[model samples]
Target: MSSTLLFFIVLAAMALAYYIGRQRAIGVVGGVSQINRLHSLPSYYGYYAALLVGLPAMLLLLLWVGLQGQILTALTLAELPPEVTADLSEGQLSLLTSDIRNLASGNLMGRDPSPAVEAAAARFQQLQQIATLSLWALTGAVVLAGMAWAWQHTKPSFRARNRVESILMLVMILFSLIAILTTLGIVLSVLFESIRFFQMVPWTEFLFGTRWSPQIALRAEQVGASGAFGAIPLFTGTLLISFIAMLLAVPVGLLSAVYLAEYAPRKVRAWAKPVLEILAGIPTVVYGFFAALTVAPFFRDLGQSVGLDVASESALAAGLVMGIMIVPFVSSLSEDVINAVPQSLRDGSYALGATQSETIRRIIFPAALPGIVGGVLLAVSRAIGETMIVVMAAGLAANLTANPLASVTTVTVQIVTLLTGDQEFDSAKTLAAFALGLTLFVVTLVLNVIALHIVRKYREQYD
Candidate 1:
């Protein structure tokens, strides 16, 4: 509810900002009729003002809302009996806060609500409502203040264009700051949880150990029991499956993309691109079922006929299905990047008596290498993060072997298994999900970086 209100508040502030900015620019230009004489267009001034007044306020609102919930939770906890707070872990505390919020909204269900808890919940609700109202009022007041200040400074002699440009520059800075902050936040969250996981299991074991067992017993007596924390098998399984998927997807997708971008007739390209994209439009879960029910069985029988041991649930089947699922990603993105390569490069190659294939391979693709690698890297990340296909068709056994006929498990599958069903929150099994998530994030990041580097290096050779 507060989020929804904050959105409207920012929108209203933006509207007011646009009006103020436009009025100021009009005054400087002598009137709306003189807009053509101004240093910048009237709309730019409005947009500049809208960005200026709304961005800072929106940032403030976001920061305030983030902190406010935590602050309210702490206060509510402090007011509660010591016994209630004593046994609560961080996860439980979060759950408690959610319950309080539910109770405050008169929607508490399951188990009779305690009187004291109910009272605290009601107060929290009242405080949230009051805070929301106050924030909206304060934001409106600030908008009005800014508008008045701009109006007073607006005159025929005033430099409204310069002011608007300055505001526009600041808005761009804010946007860049937002992107950086978001990336930083994701990395830090992963790093912190990975550190915690490492503390529980030796970093050496996680990095170098070959065995990948992570099951920990539920009781205190189970501490120091035999459970391997090695991640090698999981890593190997991920690599093998991802490799197979990529091998299947890349060549087909790239050729399709090239044909569409460079040679296909207009009607064919138009119909082909969207039809290819429809492959990506299908849900991954649907692909999972296709892998499990159809592809896996078909492969198992085929391998059996060849007198080879093919597991009913094999990485090959999952990888094949996953590859099909990723074809559209590679095709769509590669098409865009291929099309972006200057057509002059192709013309130059053709003038040298090079065939279309030779031109694409030697000139156009090299020029578009960075974007192509970017697309492939993105596809690889999607393959690595894929869960449903591996869960359904790839076996749960964490086999380190790379043979396509054998069963294998991926990191995402393990994470799902570890966290599924009723379980103790602090258990290493539950925390392993966060650890796996952190590892997955790092792998994807590295892939992206390497892809960018490869693309850059390759482009420089030809460009």
Candidate 2:
């Protein structure tokens, strides 16, 4: 059976177990009015039974789903004749196994299959059927066994609540560990791939070199194919665009937030806040279209009218649009932070003969400074990581110029370009994407660390 179908079946069984366990608990207590005599409530007993029926069976299903394909492929490979396998490399063997699976599933394999492959395909189909049947039978048995055990233990004196809570704590810990381990796995994978890339291209050259070409010739004799891996241009472009975005976003967003939070009327704030936040809900691709079609052309024409040279696709256009896109992120968070400032602080400032503007400037803004900074940092990060707006508006020319009217490309755009098609993992070009990713991760992590330090320092002072 499909995993989804099996999951629903397990859910139905757990429901039945819950009902039975609840009834059993009531029976053990002699009457519903006598439920107070039990160590735990009837609902707790039902929860305990449902968790018992679900957790173990779900765990087994997860394990089976994760490992079944590998086991089946290994078994199929072991059954293949030595003549068919002996000459095959690991890559070839993987391809052969894929063909067998495709053929067994009645999908086109793209090539005629050998007699040995046909035999293996039949065996794969048979084994898959048996695996499905066995999984269903075993899961059902486990659910039934768990339910019976839970029901037998559902006595008047049983600590059902404690058992259920303990189980829940363990599940929570398991999920936390899964999240931590998954993050570690991603970091390690990117680090290792980046190491491979650095081995092929020197770390110093990749970091400090000025040229940014990443195309290498396939043949040694080919001309003009020596790739340049200097990443300075990419980093410069990213910072330039992000800086422009923050320049446009921070003052406008923060001032707007201040107005909405401290000065605007209730009705105005209520309607205006949601209307402003609606910008966040629009898709980034739509922003990209606006940047490329409307903003970029307008800027180019305007720059020319003033006798200033401008690229058709320039950083200013992308950054302006990106800043507009991130305004809601900053304004929403900043407004909440501003509103959270103690009313007494504002009152105290006013009692000291300070005007409302002076009160906000000295008291409210400082008190909410930490959260406002955090919001700005988040907006900056969003601007830095944005790919679609940069891709569509800021033409992918890895130019290392500070002029906003010039074209530039970002690290994310280059990473996408590097790994877009059917890429060989071992090639420097593909490995470079991992290097770029790792670098971006490190840069973002550093920014977060700095932001956290600032927040903590201010938070301690304020608290």
Candidate 3:
């Protein structure tokens, strides 16, 4: 059975268990009228029974689903003759399994399968059927056993509420650990692969070298494929675009925020805020198309008219569109932060004979500065991490220049390029993606720390 259908079956069983347990609790107390004799409420008994019925079945399903793939693969492969499997390497074996999987799923898109692969695919389907049947049978039996146990224990003196709460607490902890462990697993995997990449290419060169070519020589005879692994150009381009974006985003977004939060009429604020924030809802690819088709062309033509060189895909166009895109993030957050400032500050400034502008500059703006900084920081992150816009508007050339008019690329674009298509995971080229990911992580972390420091330094405390 499919997991979703099985889950619903379990849910139905839990409901049955709950009803039976509630009836049993009432019976043990001599009737519904005498239910006060029970240690916990009858509904608590019902909840306890539902938990008992569901938990064991869910665990069984999870374990079965986890091991089902590997077990079936092994059984399918084993069904093939020794001669069929004897010479294939691990990558080839993986591909064979993939083909079998696709074929069993009726994908029928890849190369025609050999007789051995056809046999394996059939066997895989058969094993999958058997495994799913066994899963359903085992889960049903466990659910029945749990219902019986709960029915037996649903008595007047049972502390059903306490036991159910304890079980739920443990489950909450388990889910929390799942989230933490998932993050840890991702970090460790990237770190290990980055270590492998650094072994193949020097860390110093990757970090500080100005040249950014990553086309490593495949054979000793290849002349132009000598790799230069410097990431300085990637970082430079990322910052230049992000810098341009922030330059446009901050002042306009901040001032607009101030206006909306303090000066705008309620009627205007109602529709205007959502309209302004519509930019954030627009897809990045749409922004990319706009930049490539309209913004980039306009910039190139304008620059040409002024007798200045401008690449077809320049950082300026991408950054401007990106700045427009991120405006909502800055405006919405800053407006909310400004509105959060106590009205007493404004009142005090007015009482001291200060004008509205003076009150905003001296009191409200300063009070809201930390939160505004936070919004701006989020906008900066958005600009830095954006890929689709940069891909379309800024051409993918990792030129080590400070010029925003020149075509350049960010680390994210290169990461995507390196990992695209069929790749040997152990190759230095594929592994470079991990190194770039790690670098981006470190840079973002540093930015977060610096932003936090600034926020703390200028933070205003209120009574």
Candidate 4:
């Protein structure tokens, strides 16, 4: 049977186990009226029985399904003659198994298979069928055994509620550990790859070098193939664009948030907030198109009319559109934090004869400063991490210049460029992507730490 069908069957079995356990618990206490003799409610016995049946059976099914492919492939390979496998590397052997399984399942292979490959494919299919049948039998047996054990243990004195709670708590803890470990694994993996990249290219050059050409030549005879990996220009471009984005976004977003929260009528606020937030739902790729086609051209013409030089694709164009994109994030978050401030504070300010403007500036703004800072930080991160807009609007020149009209590139754009196609991971060119990623992560982390310090300081001063 299919795993999905077997999953539903297991669920049905668990439901039956629940019913049986509940009835048994009631019977043990003599009747529903005399259920006070039982330690827990009859529903607790039902839950305990369902848990007992489902947990073991589901775990077994999950492990069996996870390992079934490996086991089948191993059996198929073992059945093949020793000489057939002796010449293949680990990677080639894996590919051979994948192709055999694909052929057995009536899928196309890259080329016609040999006699040994055909035989292996047949063996794989046979093993897969046997494995599936065995899984169903084992899972059903486990469910039945769990049900019987639950039925036997559903006595009046059994602490079914405690057992159920303990099991759930353990499950929750296990999931939490999995999440923490996943995050740790990601960081360590990036850190190690970045270390490898640094080992090849000096850290000093990568960090302070002005150019970022990562095209390493495939052959030593190729001219101009030794690429530079200085990231200073990328860093400068990223900061410049993000700075411009925030410069436009923070004031517009924050002020709009204030007006909507404190000045707009209820009828206006209801529709205006949602309409404003619709900007956030628009895809970033669409913003990229708008930046490239509309904003960039407009800026070019404006700069030309004013007798100023403007690149066709420049940081100013990308930043302006990016700023518009993050407006909703800033406005929505700031509005929420503003609304969260106590009404009592406003009333007290009014009683002290403070004007509304004065009260907002002195009391409300400072009180809401932390959340405002947090919202602004989120928008900043969004701006920094933006790829499509930069790629489409700002040309990837990586020129070390402060002029917004000049063409520049960011680190994210470089990372995307370096890892765009099928490439070897061992080369410094590919490993440079990992180094760039780790640097971005560290920069973001530092920014967050600074934001936290700002929030704490303002919170202490205001509260």
Candidates in order: C-alpha RMSD to true structure: 4.0, 2.1, 2.5, 2.3
* Local lDDT at 411 for model 2: 97
List model 1 lDDT by residue over 1-463, tens digit each.
5677767967987897787778778877778798777766666667666766676677767777778877777777788878776878988888778889888877846878777778789779777887777777776676666666655655554555677678768769988998999999988876776777777888788877898777766577786656787888999999999999999999989989989998999999879888889999898899999999999999989988999899999999999999999999899988898887777788888999999889888888878878888889989999999999999999899998989889999999998998889866566666677788888988888988888887677654544
TM-score of 3: 0.91
What is the model-wide C-alpha lDDT for candidate 3?
0.90
Which of candidates 1 and 2 is the stronger one according to TM-score? 2
**Order of all candidates by lDDT, from best down to worst?**
2, 4, 3, 1
lDDT of each: 0.82, 0.92, 0.90, 0.91
User: What number of clashing residue pairs does each candidate have, in the order they appear?
Assistant: 0, 0, 0, 0
Model 3 over residues 1-463: C-alpha lDDT tens digits? 4899999999999999899888889998889899889999999899999999999999998898899999899888888899988999998889888999988888894577898888888889988888888998899899989998998888788999999999999999999999999999998999999999999999999999999888888999999888888999999999999999999899889989999988999999999999999999999999999999999999999999999999999999999999999889999999998898889988999999999999999999889888788778877878888999999999889999999899999988899899889988888888999999998887777777777887677665743
TM match of model 2 to true structure? 0.94
Error of 2 at 203 (Å): 2.2
Give the least accurate 10-residue stretch of model 1, judged by summed lDDT.
150-159
Candidate 2 residue spans exceeding 4 A from truth? 108-115, 460-463
Error of 2 at 176 (Å): 0.6
Clash pairs detected, candidate 4? none
Q: List runs of model 4 lying over 4 Å from the truth.
A: 89-91, 453-463
Per-residue lDDT of 348-370 in model 2, one digit per residue for the tens? 88899999999998889989999
| Model 2: lDDT to the true structure | 0.92
lDDT of 4: 0.91
